[model samples]
Structure formats: C-alpha cells, structure tokens
Target: MGSITVSGVGKAYKFYSSRWARLAEWLSPFHKRRHTLKWVLQDINVSIGQGESVGVLGVNGAGKSTLLKMITGTTQPTTGSISINGRMAALLELGMGFHPDFTGRQNVFMAGQLLGYQAGEIAELMPEIEAFAEIGDYIDQPVRVYSSGMQVRLAFSVATMKKPDILIVDEALSVGDAYFQAKCFQRINNFRQNGTTLLLVSHSPGDVVKHCDRAILLKGGRVAMDSSSREVTNRYLDELFGKPDEAPADAEASIPTDSAAAHGLSQHDDVFHSRPGYHPSEHRWGHGGASIIDFLVSTPDASYPSRIESNTQTEFYFTVRFDSDFDQVVPGFLLKTLEGIFLYGTNSYLSSRGTAHHSAQAGSVQTYRFSMPMALNEGHYLVSFGISSGDPRQDLVPLDRRYDSVLIHVGRDVQFWGIADLRATYQQLNA
Candidate 1:
C-alpha cells in the first residue's frame, strides 16, 4: 500500500531571543523563561491513495515547506501522527541529501542505499542515472562544485530512476532549465500513469492545474480549501483578489477622448497580417468600477499577424469601459511563459509612453494602445491584462484584470539563450 495518511499534523519550534536563552532552556526543561513556542503549521490533515496526484498550494510562509518535510520524514511533527507506507522518495530541497564531499556518481549510490536498494541494484542503475543527469565528467567530480541546476538534475534523476511507490517533489523543478523542467514534468506524468502516488508542491497555480487531480490551498497554517483543481484555483484567486462584483455606476456620463490617436495610434496600426478569425480566451477578475471590453494585438500596419517575429515591434490595443467616474486609470499587460514564469510586464503608471492619468465619467469606453518590441525568444507566451487605479507602482487596485487574455506564438527555431533575446553584439579585439 502506497497510501499516505496524515492525522492532526502540527509543527512548532521553540523560538528564543538570544543564544544564552536556548542554553538556559536546554539546561532546565521547566525553565521556559524567554523562549516562545511558534507554530509553523497547525492541524493539517489529508489522505492520499495509491496512484493519486495531489498538489499543495500556498503563498510564502504558509507552511508548505514545513508540511512537505513532515511528510518526507525529514522532520517530525510536534503534535499528531503521520502514516506513510511503501518506499518513498522526495526532492525537497536543492542539494538536500547529497554530501558535499562525495561525487555525483557516488551520491547516486548513497541515495539509492538510503532508499533501500542493494549495492548491486544501484550499480545496475548507475548508468541510467548518469545518462539522465547529463552531467558527463562532472558525475565523478565533487558535488560541491556542481551548480544549483546541475545538482537538481542529478537529484531528480536519482530519485526518479528507481520508481518509488511514493514520489514527492517540492519545487525542485524551479531550479532547472526550461527544457529540463519540461522533462521532469513528463517523468512525473509517467509516474502518475504507472500507479505511483505523487505529491507535488508549487507556488504556481498553473502547475497545480496542469499536474494534480486534486488540490489543497493552505493559508495561515491551515487548510483553506480542498477540492478539484479548478475549484481550488478559483477559490485561491478569490482569496487573493477578493470577490468580483458588478459595475457600480452607468457608463454614459464619461468623457470620450481618443487616447490611442493622441499617442499616434490609429486604425492603420492594426497589423493583423497572418492571423485569421481571432477569438479571445481570457480569465478576468477585479472590482466592479470598470471593465475591459476587448483587446487587440497587431502590428503598426493594422494587420493581425498569427505569430510575432523576433526583434520586431508589436502593438496592443486594450478597450476599457467605465461605469463610474475615476480620477486615475492604469492599463497594462504582462508576458509569461507557458509554464507561468513571468517574462516581462508594463503598465501606464510604469511606462513612459502612455498618458499620465485618465479622468472619466460613467459610460466611458476608451482604447489604450501600447507599442512594445518582441525581444523574446521563440516560444508560446500568455498575456495578462490589467486595468487599475491609484499608483500602480505602489498600492494599486485592479479595476479589471484578465489572465491569459492573449496567447502569443513566436515562430522560427531561434536558439537564443535565456528568456529574452538580448540581441547582444560581439566584436573580437586583438590581444
């Protein structure tokens, strides 16, 4: 049975003010003078059956890492019980279990032994592990010399080579390259298909939605929501951005101004060259003061191109409607990778090109267009749009925000390193 059952699990630490205070507490068990008990996780209970994929979602300091540790047996819970059956393998932290003095190849055997494998078995699996890690000669080098990415590759390869009954991955893919991260997901998917219990922890909601069958949201050291991935994700967003409501006022009393034309943007800028019959698939939320009616992504020539060319300029036209008068309005967009890693973002408050502030009455519809060059590498990107008020750089409030509003595809097999195509220039100087 590869099932995991956690009952009334809680973790706490004795926090002391000074170094001597810890000594004093150690000297006398009943002293308890200065140290305070701090609970990182409280009353967490969950059950996972064999071959089930579950995701743990939470913000920083929400005790996600603490819960993972307790499940992995790295740390014991201060209160309650945990029962885990079958062989369990975990990638909790970068370079967590490996010794600094040992080589990557040696650490593979070490980790295998810790996982209840004989020397002969580990030896047989060494070649597979070495090939999967792809660290070549560095496999014989000390692990201390390996970069964080290399260490993650080795650890992930070793943990997954043997096919444990229970596999736990805790943000380990965040350190690897994009290609390697994709490979890790494929491996995890294979584990799910082959009947291995999977427990994944990530801050990315997209990751949870893509990989987990069920998801649990942790807030303030407690279970906030537990349901299907879609329900949990929606609830998580609600908790984050507050509940969305209807517009507060009518849209007819607002001033109509040509802001796009004011910025030298016109219908001629609609460059929808190759893209045909475009339809938007967007997820929206925000306060009810205003709404984003529609948006367009094209070139300066007014042609809607199917894919963006590298190192070329593209324009984004966002049409927003206001039901109530507002003193300030901010419109923006963000580009993120398919894996939900943010690549770039800009807003009216932060951009030098857009108008400073927009004052509007009820029933106002305005279109704001932004010009940005496509300096990104060849990949599929998602655009998140936002219409907000107040200081967007500081305490901003979203009037309307849409995630994945536009899906952008940049074609051509350009082997550019990193996310942005920096367009670096090189010149050789004689020595």
Candidate 2:
C-alpha cells in the first residue's frame, strides 16, 4: 500500500536585488515583499502505485532533482504538496550530508542516524557497509580527500544498507566506474523483484527503458511527457539530440564505385592521408617498398560522411602500389574503439572469394575494397589499414600499417552501452 503522490507541486527560489533591500524589508514594521520568486518546477502532478519503477529524465536545469528533493523532504515545495507512503531512502547529490572534515566511518554513523538507525544498529551493520563500500583504509580518512567515485561508493552503500520500501537514485551513481555501476544496478534489480518502489534519474534512454516501467520527461521546468519508458525516451532523444526526420537507409544504397566519381578525387591521386576522417596522429610502420595511395570511404548516399546513423553498411576502397616485386601480398582493415581496443578485423586472404594473394611485379598497382556493417553503439571509433606478406600472428612482414588512421562518428546507432550494437527487443507475455 506504499506509493508516492505529487499534486500540483511546484518550487521556487527567492531573488533579492541587494542585501540592504532584504535588511530593510526585514527591519520594516510592515514588511513589503522585496524579493522575486524564480520558479524551478511548475504544476507537476504524478501518482505511483506500489512497486512501480519510474524514471525521471531531462537535460540539465530541467528541475528533475528539485522534484525529488521535495518528495524526499530535503526541500519544501513552494506550492501544492508531496507525500511519501513508505520508508524511503535516497542517494541524492553525492556527499550531500557528509561532513568534509569527518572520516567516512564517522559520516556513515551520522547518515545512518538520519535514516532512523540507532548507534548500536549501525554498529551491527558496519561490517556490511564497509564490505560493500570497499574503500579500504580511506574509510578512516576525512571525506574531503575522497574522489568523486569514492564518495558515491560510501553514500550509496549507506543509503542501500537496508533496502527501504522505496528507493530513489539520482545521476550521482553515473560518476562511478563501470564495475560499481553494474553492482548498483544489480542490487536495484533485486530490490525491484521484491516489490520496492523505485525512481531512477538518468540521461540515458537505454537505462530508462531497461530499468523502468514508466518515465517522466521534463523540459523548461515543466512536465513535457509522462508515458511508457520507450515512448518518453524516444521523445526525449529527439528533444535532446534533434535527430533528422529521414532515417538512415536500412539496406545499403547504390553509390558510385569509383573514387573520382564519388569523392571528387583524381583516379591517380595520392591523397589517402587527406581524407575527412584521416588521423594525423596515426602510428605508421612498415617495409619501404610498398605504399597505400588513394582511398575513399562511402555510405549509401554520401562520401566520407562526418557521421553515420544507425548500423549502416559502409565500404572502404584503397589503392596500393608495389615498388619492388613481391612473392605475395595481403591487404587488410580493422575497426577499433577510440581507446584502441580492436573490434573486428579481416584480411583479403581470409575472404570467401578464394583470391588469397595477388602477385605484382615492380611498378604495379591494385585497388582493394572491404565492406562491413558498422554494428556499433553510438560513439567515436577508429579504423586502421594494413598490408602484409604473411600470417597475422607469426612471421608476418607488415609492408604498410596505418594504425588508427580514420575516425568514424556513429550517431544513435543503438540506445545502449558497450562497443557492439546487439539489436535487442522485448515482448510482454500472456501469463
């Protein structure tokens, strides 16, 4: 029977012209209003049944945190009312109540008192809290010295020590490392399973859709949309990023095959290093007898686009010249994360075409192309090219290796995290 209710709720802050104006107003027998009210939240009405998971999503300055603070009793609403019908625990702004000069252990005791735990009860749970935080001896040091991640760890540990009937988590957890974020979400999932009402605040549409049953989107301190998480997040994405109306081509579109036709490059141009995504800081090393010259990267409609939308299949074309005769040569390309973690790579020798090696005498050139679906989440990534004479792992002689030579920006390919775009879907079942 526990739930949250927000009815015509609004919040505002006082703005005075000067300190003397405030003093004069306070000193006057008939005090006149000398301050103006700046409204941060307006006419927000929401009701949640027991155990419902709702997400509050907005860009910065949208009054999401202000509403949560009002419900949690940390701040008062300027108009209307907010009520909570459960034992509530919240992880608000990081280190909100922590004393900078106090050690983490002491702060934990103080925060625990605020949460209705007596000294003896906190002592009983101290081992569990310390085990969960895992901050080591820094737990004995002043809160001022803790990193943002460390502060989140302690705050979250204390708030979640004993799961209440309700839980409110803000974006403060986003500052933690990936491992801790995973741990926190796992705990939240377990709480949800046990019928705990949850409120998650985040900028990520993927997180909202995955963890929440419903979502409320705020814009300009007003409730913009309140609906299913998917619907609200879709609107939020368009609002936040202003995506184009025309979606990316689902299947590859027909594009000009020749570099001269597609990219306005000379057929014999040696401008591989001048392309749009070319990286000047690329690491280059190889034997000197071969060179990679003209290159082109094309989507279905554009040549060397600054950003690729969705998981579009794209092609890369490059021409290589042999200065000295070679017994055999192999051309290859690979994709990597911005931090240089390899994703997928393939060589001409490994293709199904059965054209493993090409023999070229001195003063000979050949064009090579590789096409792949950019199956990655939205982020910045790098592409590399190489030419070698042997196996990739052993006795390999790299003739021309351009490491991280091109930077590709993928836009809204997947509404999820991680490097790969694992197109996932959900369906409700009839029980």
Candidate 3:
C-alpha cells in the first residue's frame, strides 16, 4: 500500500514590483492586477509504497525543493492535494527549525517537541543524540556560535532519533564531514530496514544509485520520468550535458543504452561496448598550451568498459591530437582524485628518450595506453592527458582536457582511502 499519495499537486507564486503596484491596481477600477505568476510545480502525481525509498533528481530551479516543501506542509500547493499516511519528519534545509539563539541542547528539545516528542522522551534520548552529533561542549553553546556543520549534525541527530514514518531529506547529508555522512547513510539504511519510507533529494547520482530503488526526475516543474534509479539518473545526466542519448526503457534488459553506452559503439546484444577509437568531448584548456581528446577507460578485452568492479585490471586510453607537432613530444596522462588532486602521472618523454625526437602529426591522433593497476581505491576519479614539447612553456599543444573522463568504483574489498590502493604487506614484528 502507498504510504503517501500526491495527486495533481501544483504550486504557483505571483511576483509584484512592490506594494505600490498593488495599490495602483486597486486605485484604478479599469486596470487589472498586473502580476507575473511563476508556476513552481504543476500536475505532479506520485504514489510511494510503504518502506519505499524514492529519490528526486533535477537541476537547479527545477522545483525539487519546492515539491518537498509542499509535501512537508512547510508550504501549501496552489492546487491539488497531498495525503501523507503517517507522522513525517523533514530536513528540507540545514537547521530549518532551529533557533539561532538557542543552544544545541536547547534546540534538540525544541525540534523534538515540534516533532511531537514529549520532554521526558527528549531527555531520555539526549545522550544518544549528543553522541551521534559529536559536537562536544559546543552543544551547550548557542547555535549562533556553531559552524554550519555543527548545526546540521545537531538537527540530523534530533530528527532521526524518533524515526518518523516518513523521512524527507534534501541535500542535508552533504553538510557533514565524510565520516559523519557515512554515519548518516548507515542510520538511513537502518531506518529503511525497519520499514521507514524515505524521500531523498540530491544532485549526486551515486547517492540515488546506492540508496534508492526508484527515482523521480523533475524538469520545468513537471514529472519528466519516474522509473528505476539507474534509468532516471542516466536520463538526468544526459539532459544535464545536452547529450542527446536515450536510456533504454527497460534498463534491466540485456542491452545497455545509458550514458556509458553512448560514448562507445555496441556490438553484442547481451553487453554493449564502446568502439575502438579514442573519442573525448566536453573539452577545456589547462595550464600552458595543452588539450585532451578521446580519453576513455576500457578493459583489455572488452570493447567499451566504463563501469568496473573493485580491484579489477583495466586499460586507460586516450589520444592527444596536438595543435602543432613539436620537436620533443612529451605525452603523458594524469590520474586525479575526485577533489582534483593529482594522484599520479607519467609521460612518455620523461620515461625514456625513445620517443622524444618523434614529433606528433598535427590533426592526427596520437594514442597512449597505460595498464591501470588494480590499486585504485574506489570512488570517482578522472583521467587527464596532455602533450608538451621541450620545456612546458616553450612549445606545446594540449590536445585533450576533460573532467570526469572515467568513472571508477572501488568496491568494499579495499579498506583504505586515498588516491592509490597500495597493496602493502603488513608484517607484525614479534617483540
């Protein structure tokens, strides 16, 4: 059974220059009210089953937050109705219900009370909430004196303590540190296991893929697509980058027709793959005269492999189509962490003088291949490639520069965090 039913929900706001505009309208009997109305949402209908986790995805100004606000009763829809089956707790924004002048401990009581918890209940749960927040004595200080992260932690802990029947989170998890964010995910997962219905609004595709079974994509205040998380995410990204590619209607079927499949050509019916040539788009310039092109990741055997398992061997390939062939073409590629830190880089010219004299042909593709060691600690990483002649400043042509060139996932097997997965042998010394 659906725990929440939203039907024909719509919201609109009228914009006026000032009170004078309304006054002028009222003064003139012949004049009609000249107000510009913007529809924030229109005709949105969705049914969320009990214990179902649904993610809402959209670009900025797409009314995702507005829809959530309407559902939570923070704002009312201009038309239609929303029927929520049970008690709901919403974290639409960080510290939404918290008073800045109130201390963290005080805010806990205030928020809990607002959620219908009695004072005695809040008092009994205070220790656990405080421990989860991990804000220390700062909890005693006024919220106005706390950092944004502190406020978020306090609010999150207090909200989740009672475990409301319906939980609505809108990018609030992004406010905390990595560790805290992981903890929050764990708590949300636990809530899911206990049959709590969850609605998450976030920009991260990974979050939706990992947490939600279903997704709703909103575009221009309308439901663009309501389907599996993977399908919705792929469609959202395609729309985001103006990439004209369609995700398969049935993603579970044998054909893989998502963004990963668009870059490369597919041959087999069961598995789709990228073609052999290096093709990189979404180009930009980097430091000095360097460009990147056709940068892609693929398995040694598989034609096109974008997604890979943790601790798997793969090949990173890209072609540097230089602006001008130089006397010494120092071709290289960089492996970067998601934060833009250069984890590792190597160049053909630096490695050896064997290819130094060979000037690359302009308008011709120069291919470079590296055996990516299975030592990458998962998460998302980018591959950047460039060509420099002589000194980096003297003469050069940067053919390819692309962010998020390849998406890598290091699964649960790797226990470490950072750029590389250094398979180090630990020896316990007996004293």
- TM-score to true structure, per model: 0.62, 0.64, 0.76
Q: Candidate 3's residue-wise lDDT over 1-431, tens digit each?
A: 32889999999998878978877877888878777789999999999989999999999999999999999888999999999998888888999888889889999998999999999999999999999999999999989998889888988998898777888999988988888888998999998898899999998777887889999999999999999997897677656543335433322232222343343422223111222222234245555433443544555433233334556666665555555655666677676666778788777755554544446655544556565665665455656556566654355554334544554443333246555667778999999
Instruction: Provide the overall lDDT of each model, using Cα atoms, as 2-decimal numbers.
Output: 0.76, 0.82, 0.72
> What would the per-residue lDDT of candidate 2 be over residues 190-209, giving only the tens digit for each residue?
98899899999997666787
**TM-score for predicted model 2 compared with the true structure:** 0.64
Ranking of all predicted structures according to lDDT, beginning with the best and ending with the worst: 2, 1, 3
User: Candidate 1 versus the native: TM-score?
Assistant: 0.62
Candidate 1 off by > 4 Å: 29-33, 239-431
lDDT of 2 at 25: 85
- Using alpha carbons, what is the TM-score of model 3? 0.76
Backbone clashes under 3 angstroms, per model: 17, 0, 14
The ten-residue window of minimal lDDT in model 1 covers: 247-256
Model 2 regions more than 4 Å off: 243-372, 378-431
